[model samples]
Target: MFQLGKTIVSEDIIEKEFVCNLSACKGACCIEGDAGAPLEENEAKILDDIYSKVKPFLRPEGIKAIEQQGTWIKSDFGELETPLINDAECAYVIFDKKGTALCAIEEAYNKGIVDWKKPVSCHLYPVRVKDFSEFASVNYHKWEICDDACTLGKELQVPIYKFVKEALIRKFGQHWYAELEKVAEKNN
Candidate 1:
């Protein structure tokens, strides 16, 4: 692991290759997870604020889940997360004509209905951040469901850090990312 500013990052983030292959995985990460996407404390308020605007883009089941669960819910571990439908797919998850899972919140953002994108946790898939008082631990999440993504990323020669650049910057800021890039360059 290496330190970039206050964040401790795992080497696997640079060593691993991963790009979401939606066609192959059909966005299983959204549907098959045991819990909804993790949310920051402030994200709950954003969900409540934008529910009406995002509702139209969501499925009935998703809408119902949100209404019943309230924008976000506390997980067993006491962390905030998006609501889930029957403890299955995320409440914010919508589907395209092809049945691939998509984020209604993001759809709203794309349409300019909301300024915020989906939760940073969802944006930074394969990279989970654990925040502490002094620093944050950033580590690559190895999930069997994303095996195809790893294969495709290897084929395309995209390292995990590069593949999730925007999200990383969004979470950690440009300076932190620039330092990470330097670390990656030196390591390579």
Candidate 2:
């Protein structure tokens, strides 16, 4: 692991490759996860604020879950997450014509209905961040469901850092990402 500013980043972020192959995985990450998408403290409020706008884009099951459970729910572990449908698919999930799950919140964002792009956690998939008083731990999440993504990323030569560049910049600042790039360059 290496430190970039206050964040402790895992070496796997640079060593591993992963590009979401939606066709191969059919966005199983959205549908098959036991827990809902992780949400930041503020994201829950945003969901409540934008629920009406995002509701139209979601499936009936998702809408029902949100209405019954509220926009976000506290997990047994005390982390905030989107509510789930039957403890399976995320409540904010909407399927594309190709039957791949997508984020309705993001669909609203793309249509300019909401300014916040889904949750930062969803945006930074395959990379989970845990915050502490002094710093944050950033680690690559190795999931069997993403094996096809790993293979495709290897084929395309896209490292995890590169694939999640925008998210890193969003969570950390641009300067932090620049420093991380320097570290990656030196390591490579």
Candidate 3:
């Protein structure tokens, strides 16, 4: 790991390649996870404030889950996160006609119904951030489900950092991302 500003970033992000091959994975990350998507405290409040607008884009089961569980819930571990349906799929998960899971909140954002796209955590998949007292730990998350994505990324020659460039910028900022690029260049 190398330090960038207040973050300790893993070299795997620069070494490994990954691009979401949704056709192969079918958005399993949303529906297959045991826990709901992680959220920040502010994201919870945003969910609460925008539920009504996002509700229409959700599946019936997702809506029911959110309505019964509230916009967000404190996990048994005390982390703030989105709710789940039947303890499986995320409460905000909708699906395209092909049955690939998608975030309802993001659907709303895509339709111009809301300003927020989705939770930063959700936006930054395969790159999980753990905030500490001083620095944030940024690491690539390797999941078996995303093996196809890894293969595709390798074929496309896209590193994980490049694939998630927009999200890294969103989470860290332009200057921080630029520094990361310099570090990536040096590593390469």
Candidate 4:
């Protein structure tokens, strides 16, 4: 691991490969997780503010869950997260005609109904960032559901850092991402 600004990043992000193979996993990460997608404090407020605009893009089940619970909920540990349906699938989860799970909030963003995309955690899949008092730790998340994605990424020769470049930039910044690139280059 190496330090970049305030973040301590794991080498796995530069070494491991992963690209979402949605056709194979059917976006199982959304439906099969024990908890809902993680959310930042600001994202929770954004969801509350934009629920009206994002409502139309959501599925009925998702809407029901949101109404019953709030846009976001506190986990047992007090971390914020999206609500859940039947305590299983994420409350914001939608499905394509092929039954592949998708994010309703992202659908709204794609349609220009909302400005904010889904939660940063959702956007930065397989790359979780944990903030400490002094710095943040960035690491790759491994899940069996993403095995197909790992295989596809290996075939495509795309590393995790490259695949989630936009998200890492979004969470960090252009300069931070550029430094990360230098680190990646040195490693390669």
Residue 32 of model 2, lDDT score = 92
State the lDDT at 41 in candidate 4. Answer: 92
**lDDT of candidate 1 at residue 47, scale 0 to 100:** 88
* Candidate 3 lDDT score at position 86: 93
For model 4, how does the per-residue alpha-carbon lDDT over 91-115 read when each residue is reduced to its tens digit? 8888999999988889999988899
lDDT of 3 by residue, 1-188 (tens): 99999999999999999999999999999988789888988898898899899888988998888889999999999999889999999988888999998888898999999999999998999999999899999999999999999999999999999999999999999999999999999988
What CA RMSD would you report for each candidate?
0.8, 0.8, 0.7, 0.7
Cα RMSD, model 2:
0.8
Clashing pairs in 1: none
lDDT of 1 at 71: 93
TM-score of 1: 0.98
Model 1 residue 32 lDDT score: 93
Instruction: Give all TM-scores, in the order shown.
Output: 0.98, 0.98, 0.98, 0.98
lDDT by candidate, in order shown: 0.93, 0.93, 0.93, 0.94
lDDT (Cα, 0-100) at 52 in candidate 1: 95
